[model samples]
Target: MIVIEGLRKAYGSTPVVDGVSLRIPASGITSIIGPNGAGKSTLLSIMARLMEADGGTVIVDELDVTRTKTDLLARRLSILRQENHISSRLTVRDLVGFGRYPHSKGRLTPEDAGHIDRAIDYLHLGDLADRFLDELSGGQRQRAHIAMVLCQDTDYVLLDEPLNNLDMRHARGMMQLLRRAADELGKTIVLVMHDINFASWYSDGIVAMKAGRVVHHGAPDAIIRPEVLSAIYDMPIAVQDVAGKRIALYYE
Candidate 1:
């Protein structure tokens, strides 16, 4: 379990994440959904130790993020940011192999090679394994990045807007891939997402945030309600049950 206590981050006089305390359970998909500037990305960054928090503590399992060694933390938790830029030309396999740096330290062993292959297969990048990153499509590149994160073989994974620029089909595929990673690999996947409908459909738990604070957190049925989403987005959102899933109609 990930325990966040009074987490705070600010820029100058304005706060990005304000005393946000949340407990994210293990072995499932939990999505953070909110309007722009709600601090969703900031909170994820702080949780992964990619950014420093002004105050408060984040404990992943028994290890305090602030005190743990960088290598140790990398072994337990992995994060993929929204923007990934690779100046050097890298193949899909080459990119995925980077995840094993904590263990291999640039000298890959046979065991590390096994992890890279497994991650490539899991993300269905076997065919693209030898393909350069720039040669692949946007969705394929995103999958490669996610494959790298999974190759780290961490217990907890944090992703910021994994569905940034994908088409509808690719977006659904990405969510399904993440769902499988959680169920089959026993990974605790936490992601910052923008689409409420996608979050409602795929997430085991939905955390709603507004103005730098979490306003609500619960199951899809609880958080996908008209009142709940309407308040979160500051717009009227109608909820409907379709094929045993809650679908939010926010388009007017």
Candidate 2:
């Protein structure tokens, strides 16, 4: 489980994440959904140790995120940020191979190669494995980046706005792939999502945030109601049961 206590962050007196405490259960998909500037990405960054928090503690499966060794933590957790910029011209395979750095430290063994291959295949990037990242379309590059993170083979994966640049079909495919990773691989996936309907359809739990604080956290059926979503988004959001899933219809 990921345990957070009194988490706080600020920028020049403007609090982005305020004394927020949450418990994210293990071995399932938990999505953080909120409006822009609601600190969803900031909180994910702090959890991955990409950004430092002003105060509070985050424990990932008993390992203190603040105190754990970098290498050890990397082995247990991996995160894909919203924006990824790489100056080096790297092939899709080369990028995915980087994920094994924590274990291989630049000297990849056969096992590392196997992992890279599996990740490439998993993301359906096998055909483009030899292609340069800059040559691919935005959605393809996004898949390559995700494949790298998955190749890291960590128990916990944190993704921020993973659906960016993806078309509707690819977006649905991405969610299904994540679901497979969670159910079959037992990977714990945490993501910051803007699409509440997608979150409702795929997530085991939904954490609703408003103005830097979590407003509600519960199963899809519990958090996807009209009252909860309307309060979180500060607008009228109608929830409908479609094929046994609670889908929020906000476009009226």
Candidate 3:
């Protein structure tokens, strides 16, 4: 389990992630959802140690994120941020190979090659595997990045706005892929998602943040209600049951 205690970050005097205390379970998909500037991405960055927190601690399993050795932590936790800027010209395969650095140390063993191939196949990137990162479309590039994260094969995975630039088919596929990773592989997958309906459908737990604070955290059924949705997003939202799943409708 991931334990967060008083997680706080600020820009000047304005707190971006204010006193967030959350316990993300060891296994399952937990989604963080909120409006823009709600600090959802900031909170995820802190959890993954991609950004420093002003005050507080994040403990993943028994390892303290702040104190753990960088290499050791990378073996246990893998994160894919919203923006990936790779200046070097590299193929999709080359980028995915980078994920094995912690274990392979730039030398590809048989097992590492297997992992890279599996990850590429999992993301349906076989056709684009040889293409350079610059050649792929935005959504395709996003999938390639996710494939790299998966290739790391860490126990914990954190993604920010993973659905960005994805079409409906691919977006749904991404969620289902993460769902399978959580349920079948027993991996802990946490994501920052803007689509409440996607969160309600795929998440075992949904966390709602607003104004830099976590306003709600509970099972999908508990968090997907009309009142709760309205309170979190600060907009009128209607929820309906479709095929035994609660889906939110914010369209006016």
Candidate 4:
């Protein structure tokens, strides 16, 4: 399990993640959902050790994220951030191959190649594997990046807004892929998402943040109620029992 204690972040005097204490289960999918500037990305980055926290501690499994060695943590956890900018000219295959670096140390073995090929197939990048990152469309590029994260084969996977830039079909596909990774591989997958419906459908647990604080965390049904939705997003939200699941409707 990932345990967080007194996690806090601030910009000047404004606290973005104010005293967040959370325990993300060791298995299954957990999605962090919130509005813009709610610090969802900031919280996720801190958990993944991509960014530093102002105060508090994040412990993944038994390893303290702040103190663990980078390579050791990389072996156990892998993160794909929301905004990925690359200045280098590299093909999809080349980029995904980099995911194996922690294990192979820049010298890929046959096993590493096998894992890379499997990840490419999972994301349906066979057709575009040879194409440079600059050549693919935004959604396709996003999938390539996802494939890299999965190729790392870490037990804990954190994706900051994996659905961004994806079309409806691809977005659903991405969620299902993560679902399979969690259930079948026994991986713990945590994601930051803006689309509430997607998070409600695929996540085992939902963490709601607002104004730098975790206002609530619970199962999908518990967190999807009208009151919870309305309070979290600061909008009128109505939930309906649709096909046995609580579906939130916020649009007027």
Estimated TM-score for each candidate: 0.96, 0.99, 0.99, 0.98
For model 4, the local distance difference test gives 0.92
Per-residue error (Å), model 4, residue 31: 0.6
Model 2, residue 40: what's the lDDT?
A: 96
Comparing 3 and 4 on TM-score, the stronger one: 3
Per-residue CA lDDT of model 3 for 1-252, tens digit only, reads 999999999999999999999999999999999889999888889888889999999999999998999899999999999999999899999999999998888999999999999999999999999999999999999999999999999999999999999999999999999999999999999999988889999999999999999999999999999999898878899999999999988889
Each model's backbone clash number: 0, 0, 0, 1
Error of 2 at 223 (Å): 0.9
Off by more than 4 A, model 3 = none
Estimate the Cα RMSD of every predicted model relative to the unseen true structure.
1.2, 0.7, 0.7, 0.8
- Candidate 4 has which clashing residue pairs, if any? 16-212
Q: What is the lDDT of residue 62 in candidate 3?
A: 91
TM-score for candidate 2:
0.99
- In model 2, what are the clashing residue pairs, if there are any? none
lDDT of each: 0.93, 0.94, 0.94, 0.92
lDDT (tens digit, per residue) of candidate 1 on 138-207: 8899989989998899999999999987778878988998899899978999999999889989999999
